[model samples]
Target chain A: MKLSKWALALGIFTSVALLAGCGSGSSNSSDGVTTVKVAWRATGKGDSMYRIYSKKWIADFEKKNPKIKISLQPINASEGDYFSKLDLAMKSADTTPDIVNEDTFILPADAKAGYLEPLDSYVAKWSDWDKFTAALKKGSQGSDGKQYGIPGTTDARGIWTDLVVTKKAGLAADWAPKSWADILTAAKKIKQTQPNVIPFAMGVSTTNGESVSMQTFEQLLYGTGETLYNEKTKKWNVNSKGILATLNFINQIYNKDKTGPSLSVVMSSNYGSTIFQDRIPKNQVGMAMDGIWNTGNWSKDGAAPIANMTKVLAFNLMPTEKGQKPGYVTMAGGWSWALPKNSKNKKAAWTVMKAMNTKQLAVTRALQEGTLTVRDDAAKDPEYLKKPFIKEATQALQNAHFRPKNDLYPKVSIAIQQMVESVAAGRKSPSDAAAKYATDVKGIVGDSNTDTQK
Target chain B: MDASNVIKNKPHKTQQQKTERRLSVWLMLPSMILLLIFFLTPMILTVVFSLTNLSLTGEAASSLHFIGFQNYLQMFKDPALATSIWNTIVFVLFSAVIGQCFFGFLIAFMMRGKNKTFRRIIGLIIIAAWVTPEVVVGFCWVAFLGDNGTLNMLAHNLLGMKPVAWLYTFPMVSIIIANVWRGTAFSMMVFQTALDDIPQEVEEAAVMDGATRWQLVTRITIPMVKGTIATNIMLVTLQTLGVFSLIYTMTGGGPENATSTLPVFMYKQAFVSYQLGYGTAISLVLLLIGALASLLYMKILKVKI
Candidate 1:
């Protein structure tokens, strides 16, 4: 009996160990080909569409290139968590993906860490490199004087105003403010005309950190001709007159004008849903300072598909102060595809990236995903410019400023967000907030490293 | 006869004893080695890493400058760090102590004399929630309590009132509700086991003496489950102190850092701010708090075994 029990235990243990071994082995050898792994973020609408589109692309690519296979790993985490996970995975060669989707802001920092490969040589050899625009090329270049990634899609930020509300407020249906004063005056008029509607919507809550900093604050800062970094001096810039004026304008919006949603509502991740699904369709938000991609959700198959959105809503270029020649300013950001330094399949990854950036592919993705392409051919394509909102956003791109493409830009952006938020909440005056921001930026990049030339 | 006795005892007995001792040591070696490798090694590495200036960004720093207590010093200076510590303490005291343990014992006591079918149904319902994923629970709670959520919809459409932003106005309370909903089941199961172990005859004797249900419960049942309650409190307190998913998903330490607990703060510092050394310092402090809480609970419980 004792011998029989011992034999039974050993058999059970052997079977369990074998099963565990098979589980891991099967995952590695499912397709009998070298799988090139890729990681990218998946949002609510983008995930479903991208999955369907990429599957088609992958099948076609695999048919031509028989030896190579693609395993697209979609991470459905928030932007911050996605970056953290990707960074952690890149720390080890075994876990690193062959290709990574990175934000423009983090590309320089990632390159500095030696986590990403410089693609300058690859670009030099590629015949299609000239198809990319100059601004897009500059945006992808790192401080090491080497290009680190291929800029995929660039986007512009602007105000999405309800035409009906604007008309009610005695403003033209195509009202485009030329200065800070014009925006405030329009907001006040809308507030009086539509008592129940929020006249302006600006995000101040920390929950949507980078979005608020880039889309909301930087839009205003650049409109005033102040920027986060002064490239001429290679220093962080925080104590500019434009920076202080932008802070005061945000404070007035929150405290004095009371034209926007409360700070809490602005900060919520569901703020997008509030504007798109609840507020805009319901005509409860007069004007929303949002991205060009808002129209993506108003299409026939969108989450909140409003058929009248084209007539009831209009896009306006976010106006520059004093109606400058371009007449508007915008903050532009984009995503890029880069090869990790440790990726064993760097050559294969570059080939896949090259195929993905073909003029046809770029135009198809830009139209279907509502993304503005960085390629000149894709941007100027008749199919792209035919869309009314896209036409307006493209115009804004002419005056749009990219975030400081420095390694310390992310930290500097966070400091700017916090300073703006503090001012908006009436916790600090504009001068005080700018002073605090200057101190924090000085600490982050060092005092001697920054010059506010403006 | 003496020769025969010596022959019988000398070789086999010594060999058997030596073999048994060797076998026992060999049996324990694997587990001991595994514990050292998995637990002790990482712990030592964390301690060492906390002292250095290693960062995710891989910025240049003077290597391993034995900064003594400089990291800890910096932790105190961080405004976010102090707020996180306070939030953690409040979360542990309210959600773990009063919400989970106290309410769990009350429910357990009430169900002890109830019908078997009813008790099973109620227990299953609570367990179902406890087994749900933390992130799912957070999302559900946010949907229920958001500004234009079900609660506000009810307040506006049915109750004829202005909508309230539950998450914005009371971030901590929202998290507490979610944590309590998920965690109370554990305490309930613990108390159930302890209550079952108590002899039924003692309760019968008290009942026959015409003692009221409340009186008997307070006097007999309360004292009987005191040790179990202490143990449950300690376990749950430690578990809740490390909760990151719920708060991270729901508030992300926002509405002005209203709900930033220690673990979330550590994550923000390490991942968000890329301050790896300072984050590790916060983690060490969190570990110390957990250790102190466990020690205090053990002393109070005073289990003889």
Candidate 2:
């Protein structure tokens, strides 16, 4: 009787294990065609740039490659959530998509963790690989000195101003600020003119996620002409004049001047959409120091779909502090097509990826997503530059700074975000926050991997 | 009755009993396996992960190792954890215990002898909130409480007041009110059912003694339903402790972690910061607090019996 019960228990355990295995079993080739799953952001109140491009590109890729069937897995989330979900999915063989739209900044860490497949061998043979910009090509390189992805889109940050709001505030509608002070003066004027409307809005809260790091903090930090990472010494610039100045700048707008959105609004995780979809269209915000991609929202088929977005808004270059060398400043980042290490159809995914990155599709994608093409040929294409907003946003690329794509950037970014958040909330003064940031970075990456600067 | 116990005289009954027992074992095997695999495995894994230096990504992800009580120790040093715990306590104290229980009982008491139509209308409104999805409730509250939201607009028009950022300035107060509004329905229904079970004569006798309304409530009714109130408080407190989406939507634990509760703090650490071990350690602390509350409530309930 004991033996029978034990045998039955064993049988049940095996059956349950088999049952669980089949539930999440990977769907490999069955009907003589390999299925390649592609993931990209598509759903949200914001722009459906990927959705527009994916619908057409999927058809084109499948048509070109007869033996490969492409499956589209559209993750509808913010940048932070999208990548986090991707990381979760990539941890398992069954959940990982064959081709994922990865942020270039995260590729290094994902590659280092053995989550993504190195794509160097595949890219080397591709004839069009040479057409990708060198800096952008560097974005796809992993910490192990291997290529993990191919850049699909690129973007630069600048000021997105509402002409109506600026003109009403007695500032020139197409004004170009020469220095940091010029921007502040404009902000003050706008604030003096319109007491109810937020004069200058930039993300400075934890809820804003990487946006606080890339768009607001980096834009200001890079403009100070001091970098967070010293590429020369290979150590993080923990305590620096640039960081302190950036924090003080945030303190100025948010705390001292009270020109930015109220802390409540800035503290919202969903305020990115709120700014573009609600505030800007409603003329509640005068200006935003943000990315080039938001202009897509005002396109005819875009989310907000303003009738004359270009006429109403200006995309001016973010100028450096004190009008230093390389007088304007901008930060560049974009998405890339990467394959997970556990992806079953690596070659099939590459084939689909190559098809997706063709010159024609790249131009269409650039137009749809309000991003610059990573491909040199596509960047030069007239169709990509036909949009006036894209043409103007392209100017920011000349003086742009890409984030240090490495193993520690992600952790370091959190510290930088906290530093900015503290100042934005008036919880810490600029110097104290910078000092605390130095301590936090030392805690994260060790004092050996860090340096202080004036 | 078992075949062997009731009809032991038959020789074939013993064999038949063995076959019946085997069949029952075969039937229960699936659920037993499922419970062992699904429920017990994750519980065990969470305990293991909490004791290790596990991260969601980067170097530690691929090579997880045991780190003892380091994560738990880190919690003591993390000011955010203390802030979140205090927020959770304040939230549970004000929103669940005081606000929901008080308003729920008050509303139920007020509607005791009302007309059927009035009762049905009030009942539907309360139940509607309960039936609605948490995310939808979150969005509704956001629209109602946001700076450019309905409340501000209404106040600006009606009271001629300058627009006040209700959610920003009073993040905790806003979420507390929203939680009380959303959660009172459950407490109301519990109290209502308990109040209904009370014999009408219990209250009538107190009235016959010339007791005032408040005195009648304090002396006779409350003492009678003390056990039910204990059970209700325990249930609501647990429910309110787990509330993530509502506060997440409204405040996102922002304005410098002013409104971050335990669950929200866990989410930020686990998902946002991608510190899996640290997040799990925090969750274990949360579970400990919950278990203690349950024990305390159970003791109160036992005292009444």
Candidate 3:
């Protein structure tokens, strides 16, 4: 009886002590100075770059506005964790940061949650707002037709080819496939010659999140003349020939031809490193459906310098299904700067935003981070044009497609990732995966909000 | 005069006993109040949240509505949830019950009457993994099991074999090994302490009666420390069921949801999907499973309360 009573008492005491420390205090304005809480997702080497940039930006802002202090918080985590952490922090007024670097894909959802303050009024006052590309501005606009963020950079997705492997497969060094069949023919030949190398690499699993959607699945799905979302109907498109054909494409590469990387590698969380850091450099991968930033990793200033990258590696727009009208398709995704709804120092936060989202900064970031320019002025900058892949990707941006910026797109994107993984793993057939995807999408957006492509 | 004094003393004595009982109840008040405010309150809130359509966003958090078992009903239809439940069971069975308790006990049993220096070294090594922070352990295992990791390198150089992605091909088994590697120290230490308490005379008598090694362990040593075995299993199983960061860091429940356990699933639903209501409902299921496992151990051990 004594032991039971003691255990109960100990349990209760420990729990209460934990709860008593739950609430955290937010920054407050004092006599003359206001503190602005600035937060961004910085993982791996990006943390140091963000830190350096933020320090300079903060110092510049504080010099101009002496009464305001910048409290920069760098969340060192993966992109997925960063999103969830930012969302959780924004749920409460006390924990919310003043300014955050929001993924453009999540801008609509965050705005819907009332975590983000619409920047329409601020953008209307800003002089350089008109300098941003219309497509980028649209990417940051919420479903309610309100501007929620200022986009930083947009990345164009395409196929990265190793000329060495292509030449070995008896393909021309400047080979650019006009259709899906042409790409497959090359992959087949590479498999026959190299035997050990992965003929093609694409993220086909839930492990890589948006990478699987933009880099692989969407690149293919858009070429089929169908999209995940129907802008005209404002409903997600599922159960369509386009989606099944996309899945079949994945199935053929993974199962029939076995030219793709092992499904297990595709499903591994760190598989991106294997493709970028190992396979491509070793010329062990023939072709890869990846972003333009992939080549940026091999930039002159980067950790690895593939000497004469322009000679060894080449890129082309992902071709449409039958090389039909437009002939090629690409999808654009990017990050944005957003203000939290409960920011204590909104004016100061706006100053930070303006400081960070400048044409000069855009040019610098494009060169430094290997990101495509989001602003028209930055795209024309000589420094930006000099970059290896930037010139080519900027031209492809005209043919680029943007994902649906609705609040449900994040969940829908995850469902697409799951569908790709299931089919790639041979756990489900293309038809079964498509069916499951349709059901998952319908459940998320409601059946009334979705439509069959037919 | 003597009779009147005796009656007055008896009444005073009874009053003193009543006051002592009242004091005992007062001593328990702070604990009861703490339990009501902290433990009971959050559990009740979870139950309430499980019945609603609350989410991180999308008109749900602003105006949550009661859906009455809708989330629970949907759980049954989710194939991924079923896979998570199965993975969690496999993880607990392998990592906790069989791996930690049985193997740890065997190690402890073998170490009896062994060299003190050797025993201390082995104990310290095992305990080191447990004492290290969970995230560090996770990263260590990733490096050890990665395609280009230590295990693969050793296999390539030593055995003349090709490198393999250990975490991908055997996601469940890999994590189980990691959990066991990190957690078996607790069971081993506990069982070793229990073994020390066993009288040496009884074991010597058993050996004199011609009892073999296997028979001695099964018939004598195990029966003697049955209580420790039961308690160790209960503790280890509960701890393993709640593992999140280690698995999340290593695999993030990937290789196609093959390593997603209950906690990982709950986190994905609650935080990733932002479906707080559904995630809480799944958490309650995890809670129930933990309670059930504890109860099973208690019943088998004949442990009361």
Pick the DockQ winner. Answer: 2
Please report how far candidate 1 places residue A165 from its true position, in Å: 2.8
Tens digits of lDDT, candidate 3, A1-454: 5544665576567556656666554447767788877788764564334633657777887899888888878887655567788888888788889889888888888898888899999999999999999878989988899999999878887888999999989998779999999988899999999997899888886767777877788889899888888888898898899999899999999989999997546766667877887778888999998888776568765645588888898887789988987888898888898999877778888987888788888887877667787899988988888888766687678788888878887778878888998888777899999999989988888898877776
- Interface C-alpha root-mean-square deviation, candidates in order: 5.6, 4.6, 6.3
Runs in model 1 with CA error above 4 Å?
A1-33, A46-54, A239-241, A262-265, A277-284, A300-310, A321-327, A420-439, A447-454, B1-34, B58-70, B153-159, B200-220, B299-305
The whole-model lDDT of each prediction reads 0.79, 0.83, 0.84
TM-score of each: 0.87, 0.92, 0.90
Worst 10 residues of 2 chain A by lDDT: A45-54
Model 3 misplacement above 4 A: A1-23, A46-54, A262-265, A277-279, B1-38, B157-160
Instruction: Answer with 1 or 2, whichever has the higher DockQ.
Output: 2
The weakest ten consecutive residues by lDDT in model 3 chain A span A43-52
| Ranked candidates, highest lDDT first | 3, 2, 1
Query: For candidate 2, lDDT tens digit of each residue in A95-161?
Result: 8899998888778888877899888889889998998988888888887778888998899888888
Q: What would the per-residue lDDT of candidate 1 be over residues B153-198, giving only the tens digit for each residue?
A: 9889987988776876788998998899899999999998899889
Give per-residue CA lDDT, model 3, range B27-114, as digits (tens).
6666676688788999999999999998876556557799999999989889888999999999999999999998899889888989
- Grade the docking of candidate 1: acceptable
